[model samples]
Structures are given as C-alpha cells and as structure tokens.
Target: MKITQKDVEYIAHLARLEVDESLVDKFADQISRILQYIDKLKDADISGAGLMAGASLQNNVFREDTVKVSPGPDVTLANAPERHEDFYTVPRVVG
Candidate 1:
C-alpha cells in the first residue's frame, strides 16, 4: 500500500492535474490506499452472481404512449402576447 512521490507525480501528469509539490506525499498515500482497497476487492468471491445493470429488478417500466387532448391552437395562442398564424412569434435571436 506504500506509494512514492514519483508515483504521485506520474499520476498527476497522466490526469493533467497541477498538483502542489507539498501535497504529493498526502496524495500518494490516498492513491495507495485506494489501490490497496481495489486489490483487496479482487480477493473476494462472486463467481455465480448474475450481472445487474441497476439496483431495481423493474425493466421497461413506462406509461402507455397515447395522444391526449391538450389546449387547442386558439387557447394556446390566447396566452401568447404575439402570434403569427397558429404559432407564437418571437424576435429573431440570430440573423
């Protein structure tokens, strides 16, 4: 679980991080512990377990896609301060 200053520097370079020289030792220790934890996880057994994409067992849970009547064009146009034909018109954003 021991990590060196050189390892920290290398990791920082790979990550494109501007790490402080003083914090290199601390960063190295933290990274080393993370690697050690991963190494420990590799020793555990999970051979027969099914692969799970998410926590819940529910799949394709959705409401039926059906068209329902909302407000008509006239009712929608009434809410708009300005409208052209059946659509709301706004100031041009770009030429």
Candidate 2:
C-alpha cells in the first residue's frame, strides 16, 4: 500500500487534523513504510503455533469470602449530631 500526499491530505481532513505542508511528505513516507511492514508480517508462517486465550496465566487473585460480626448501631452512630432510635436524623429535603 503506497501512501501519497493526496492520501495523507484526505486522512488528515477525515480526522480533523491540521497537518503542516512541510510534514505531508514525511508523514506519507512513514505511513507507507508502516503499511509495507504490515504486508511483510502477513507473509509470516504461524501454522505450527498454538492459539492462546490470554497473555498471562494468572487467575482469580481474590480473597475467599468469610462471615464477620457487625459492629452494633451504638458504635456505628457515635459521631452523628442527631439520632432517632437506630438511625441518623437528617433535615427534610422535600416540601
């Protein structure tokens, strides 16, 4: 895939990029080289290679679930300025 100045201009217009006129040729050359490298990679042989589900082998890095005792409401609501029985009292928000 050969990249030309017109291709660069069209791509820049689609991406809403303001590519400088001096850098158009440089960008075209770089993009052409990248596409050529990709084409070269497409010709590589991988018929004997095994398919991989993931890059790493690590799995389930989590602690086991366990039942724990809850701190009673008295300890939980100790810092509240106003309390009603077992709940913190807040000012009414709706009229």
Candidate 3:
C-alpha cells in the first residue's frame, strides 16, 4: 500500500490537477498512510454481522396518497412577477 511520487504524479494527471512540485512528497506520504489504514480495515472480521437496510427500526414511514381537488391557476399564478392570462411570461432566451 506504499504510494510513490510517480503514483501521485500519475493520479494528478488523471484528475487534471495542477499539483505543486513541493507538495508531491507530502501528498505521497499522506496517500500511503490512507491506503495502509484501508488495508488494516479490510483485515477486520465481520462474518457474524447481518446486513440490514437501515439503522432505524421503522420502514416506509410515509403518509398514504389520496386524490384531491386542484388549487386552480389563480392561487398558482398569484405570486408570479409577470403573467400572460393563465401562463407565466419570461424574456426570450434564444434568437
């Protein structure tokens, strides 16, 4: 899991990043430590654990849908800055 200077440079090139020359060594060391930590985590035992959807006990806590009357155009267009009859008007975007 050792990260080299060349590896850092290659990663920077792939990400289209302009990594400073002075920070290459620092970045390489930090990346190496991160990879080592990940390797350590991979070695942990989790065979006894059971996979669950979420941490909470509740599932699908939503209200049931019901058909209702529409509010109509008056309430919908009341706050509009510019309206043309029942439709909203805006500046022309395309020529």
Candidate 4:
C-alpha cells in the first residue's frame, strides 16, 4: 500500500497527465497515507451486520395498469402545417 514517487509518476503516465516533478513526492505521501487509512478498515467487525439487498426499503415499485382515452386525430394534427386525414405530411426527399 506504500506509494512511492515512481508509482506516482507511473499513475500520472497512465492517466496521460503531466504531473510536476515538485508535486511527485507530495502526491506519493498523500496517496500512501490514504492507502494506510483504507488498510486499517480491514480490521472492522461486520459479523453482526445484516446482508443488504439494496439501500431502498420499498420493493414493489410498479404502478397499476389502467385504460386511458386517446385525444383523437383532429386535436393531435391541429398543429400540423399539412395534414392528410389524421397524419402530418412532410416533403419527400430522394437520395
């Protein structure tokens, strides 16, 4: 888990970043400390904890199926510039 200056340079290279030479040591130290903190989490007890399916409590998320009336062609095609019966007409294009 110890992050070296070389490791920082390698990470920067993988990310295609131009990391300044002066900040390499600083970044290495910061990353090493963060990894050390995360390593300490391995000792945490979780034997009594329940297995979580998800964070949300509610499971039944579906809505009830119901019939609805349509607005019909007249109201639907009212905004069209050119309408034939119940449809909007567009200019045909040839390739």
Candidate 5:
C-alpha cells in the first residue's frame, strides 16, 4: 500500500488535474496511509453477523393488499390553480 510520487503524478494526469509539484509527495503519503487502512479492513471477522435488517422487523415481510375505486379527476384536481383538458398546467419549471 505504499504510494510513490510517480503514482500520484500519473493519477493527477489521468484526472486532468494541475497538481502542484510540491504537493505530489504529500498526496502520495496520504494515499498510502488511506490504502493501508483499507487493507486492514479486509481482515475483519463477521462469522456470527447476519445480513443488515430493520430494528423492529425482519426481511421479506409484507402487509395485505386492499382495492379501492378512484374518485375521478374532478375531485383530484379541485384545488389546482390551473387546468386544461383534464390535466393541471403550471409555469415552465426547467430552462
């Protein structure tokens, strides 16, 4: 996990960045430490752990479905500011 100045320079070139020459060594050292920390995480033990779950419920649980009839567009759009041809109209939102 040891990063060199050359590696930093190459990464900067690939990213189209204008890294200062004086900061290359600093970046290499910081990257090396970060990679070493990540490498250490690979050794974590989790044999007894289960998949992530909710605090109060288990996975794959669902409620019963119910059916209902729609109240029509008149009731749905009653409070709209503007309407045309069974649809609501608003000012252009995007440029």
Candidate 6:
C-alpha cells in the first residue's frame, strides 16, 4: 500500500506521462492513499452481496412492429444524377 517514488515513476513511464520532479512525490502519496483504501476494503465482508445485471431499473422498452409506406420511386430517384427506369445508374467498374 505504501507507494514509493520508484513505483510512481514506473507508473508514469507505463502511462506515457511527462511527470515533473516536483509532482512525483505528490502522485506517490496519492497512489499510496488509494492503495491503502483498497487494503481497508479487503477486511469488509460481502458474501451476500448480489450482482447487478444492469445500471438502470428500466428494461425492454421497444416500439410495436409495423410496416410503413416509403416514398414513391419518382421521389426517391429524383436526387440521382442519372437514372434508368426505376433505378439509379452508375458507371460499371468490374472488368
């Protein structure tokens, strides 16, 4: 739980952080405190704790399945630069 200056430097190197000499001591102390809190949590009992399936209470929010009429072929093809019959026409690239 007691994070050393070397540990902080190693962590900074692994994370690709450009830590100044003045901030290394501060970061080491903060990381040590965090590890101490985790060590404290190891003593607590949670044998009966239930696992959470989701983050929210709401579930299965879905709309009814229904078919809707789309725009007519003329309206759909109106935006195309070139069209043949009811489809858009483009240059063929395959040999």
Each prediction's TM-score against the native? 0.46, 0.45, 0.46, 0.45, 0.44, 0.48
lDDT of 5 at 88: 99
Question: TM-score of the candidate numbered 1?
Answer: 0.46
* Order of models, best lDDT first: 3, 2, 4, 6, 5, 1
Best candidate, TM-score: 6
Question: Hey, what RMSD does candidate 4 come out at?
Answer: 12.3
Residues 42-81 of candidate 2: C-alpha lDDT, one tens digit per residue: 7889889997888888876887799889899999999989
User: For residue 9, what is the lDDT in candidate 6?
Assistant: 90
Model 3 lDDT at residue 75: 95
Task: Give the backbone clash total of model 2.
Answer: 0
TM-score-better candidate, 1 vs 2:
1
What does the lDDT read for residue 7 in candidate 5? 89
> How good is model 6 by TM-score?
0.48
Tens digits of per-residue lDDT, candidate 6, 1-95, equal 89999988998899998789999999899989999888987887979999789998987899988988989899999889999999988899788
Q: Indicate whether candidate 1 or candidate 4 has the larger lDDT.
A: 4
Residue range 1-95, candidate 5, lDDT tens digits: 89899989898999999789889889999999999989986788978979665686655778778778988999999988999968999888999
Residue-level lDDT for 16 in candidate 6: 97
Report the number of clashing residue pairs per model: 0, 0, 0, 0, 0, 0
- lDDT head-to-head 2 vs 6, winner: 2
Off by over 4 Å in 1: 50-95
Tens digit per residue, CA lDDT, model 1, 1-95: 77888988987899998789889989888888888888887777989987888999688789989999988999878888888999899999999
Candidate 5, position 82, lDDT: 97
- Residue-level lDDT of model 4, residues 2-38, one tens digit each, is 9899999999999999789999999999999999999
lDDT (0-100) at residue 17 of candidate 5? 92
